[model samples]
Target: MFSATVLWLLLAPAAVSAAPLTALTDCLTSSAVPQLLTTNSKYALAIKPFNLRLPFTPAAVAQPTTVAQVQAAIACGVAQNFTVTPKSGGHSYASHGLGGENGHLMVDMKYWTNVTVDSSTQIATIGVGSRLGNVAQALYSQGGRAISHGTCPGVGIGGHVAGGGYGYISHTQGLAMDNLVGAQMVLANGTVATLSATENPDLFWAIRGAGASFGIITYYKFQTFAAPNSNIVYSYNIQFTAANYLALQNYANTTMPAEMNMRMFITSGGLQLEGIYYGSQSAFQAAISPILSQVGNPYGSTSTMGWIQGLSNYAYMSLTTPIDYDIFSKSLMTVAVTPAAAAAFVAYYQNTARTVSRDWYLIIDLHGGPTSAISKVPMDSTSYAHRNALFKYEFYDRVDSGSYPSTGFSFLNGWVASLVNARKKRGQKADGCKVPTTTFGMYINYADSSLTADQAHNSYWLTHYARLSAIKKSVDPNQVFSNPQAINSK
Candidate 1:
């Protein structure tokens, strides 16, 4: 048998090092795929990460237009013993789109952008490079349809949907992954596989929530909902006060409706609420009344908008909508925030906001209700484990556009610990019952760059981690598709 580095020795110049990167470069050189090496000037712009903090340099960037070229890139990575990762929108919080580390193979999926909807079936098929905004526009224009997705118009649908996408309408519809009918991906050994409920069922389950760990999805087919053209959009600024804080906490724990989706921003300075009500102004008034009555009302306004306008409105909090500010974020999913935990959180937040030289905030989005569509999804149906979460909180702190402060993570880290620890403190009472501290968990989409492989698998997948590992070992025995947080084969 020939050596794996045989091509490296023959094709690569004598000075080039091994692990056969030189061989991989040579293989890509001959393939139809558009290849950009580190030496190339445009490689920097092409591989520029959305999160500037986690920087990386790949062995080469492969921009494949056709299915076969994508296969070709994978085959080359195999021969050269290089790690391969797909770049959909480059919006990974940990910059996993750039391979999350140096000297790996980056498959830039920018050229495969296509959004086609079947007017008859109302099922939409989208390509890997398609952004959320473009997908929403196509869904609305093609068939007056929509899907539950994130607000960032620039986020790539591949990663977003693969990681359990959610938005304001998720309570009414479901997560973006819940909409998927089928998906097409290229596996580690240059095998192109199409997955759905009946086809490659096991792999389908793995990719739906933890897709980035397994393979590169080429496109997705989703069930769509009739686009909501007439909707109520509201914004409010509430004064920071103890009464207001407790009132909002009680309100969050109970009383939210399925049709009324909301997210609140809490900081050391003040509090703001913004979201949509998929109903008329009068109905929205009734839905929002409980919170307003308790908080004693503050500065706010409301307006009606079509589906298109809402996407533009979010463009989500550093991310225009104050943070639209953070260079880092910690996401937590919980069934409910107990009264004690809430009070502890507010007190800590208020106290920290004044002392910390840096700025931080929390965007807690309501996702649970008696009739919430998200909760109805069975825990075993998809790889997404947080199906029953009542709320998803993303904690963020602003780090300016430069090298991240070496010791900058302390504030949010302590903030998360405070809430988790406080949850069990005094057996936190809520609705006359003690709430457990183990309920809240970290999220996968808001990937933290600081976690280890085991920590990430446990944090993101929880009980589903074992099955995902077994599937990873079966499909990707060599582990071609991976990043720092990627699932390891059992």
Candidate 2:
């Protein structure tokens, strides 16, 4: 049996002699390890994080083309005692995929993308490096199938599915992780393991939610759903003043159908309630008639298009330009947005938009309906603990990199925190349409850098934290895979 000290000595680079650093660099550069990118390489920036807030620079980035190469990278990192972080889509808000801090070994998974679909089973085996768009295109083209994933097309399947991905159709099909049937992972000890409900069940559950901490995921097998017939999706964008925000919330809480996803965006311009319905136009109108009747003369429009086309229309990559921006993000899962909370957010957003040059936005995703199978699975069944949340709220603010003054960044961070705090004060907890209990929880995928380890653990896993920690200890006793908010073995 390995003692804790021995495990640290085996896994921690600091515990190893200084000579290994030179050897580690040599080994990485040799033909033995293929597609490795060092700091001085042009592709080094390819490993650069999607989120620029934390400019974390890893010592070297390895772009492994095969599972064997992934194993080799891990083995090298373990032997050299350097921290190794796996980068898939490089979309980590805290930049954990880029070593979180710096001087660690980064295994870039971009070159590993490969998608294969089994038509009879309707299961798609997607490489961890594959982006959401790649998966969608492959599944739709090959099998006419789809799985619930995030809105961002560029998001890597590695972290997205592992962190409990949710998106426009999630209310109907459940989250991306929920659809997971199996996965391939490289454990901390440089061992490749296959995980599923029956195979390595504990590690399977851990990776479904807290994947980054346990191992480097290589591929995911998902139970895909047949695409909706007609491939037609109807969307309505209703523009309203802040005064009407509460009315929209009430409508969403009571009248919205599970098949239709409603996302409310509070922006500098005003409040915009966007609804995407999966069925025909008539069904969409009938389902949303209650809300429409309440709001008089609101500016809005409805359109229908193919499923893939709709995905392209709503793709985050197409909507937002590629520019490095310093950003701060936070999230909350609440029963419903109370009138007071809505009013508070409106006032703060108005003030900030008017006063600062920074761009900020608030998006609320309505959860719960017959389509939301999230409650069908018990909270403890997986590491995703927010199975009972009624809505997911995200607050994001950004300024051009290096443009914000010292005080400017602090102000933006404070504003995002205040929005969540305000909701907590006024919000009531409901267990997936059950009676009110306490305040709501938070989503793990939108990891907040401002949160301490304890705070993040509490927010993401809640009651499941103990079980997740036990699994972390079982799989990664040395804490080889860790970050500010990574699950701790202790």
Which pairs clash (backbone N, Cα, C closer than 3 Å) in model 1? 317-324, 318-323, 318-324, 318-325, 319-323, 319-324, 320-324
TM-score of model 2 (CA atoms): 0.86
Candidate 2, residue 19: lDDT: 68
TM-scores, each model vs. reference = 0.89, 0.86
Task: Write down the worst ten-residue block by lDDT for model 1.
Answer: 317-326
Clashing pairs in 2: 13-81
Cα lDDT of model 1 by residue, 120-149, tens digit: 898888998988887888788886888889
Clashes of each: 7, 1
Maximum-TM-score candidate: 1
Q: How accurate is candidate 2 locally (lDDT)?
A: 0.73
Model 2 spans > 4 angstroms off: 1-20, 29-31, 35-40, 229-253, 316-324, 369-371, 409-440
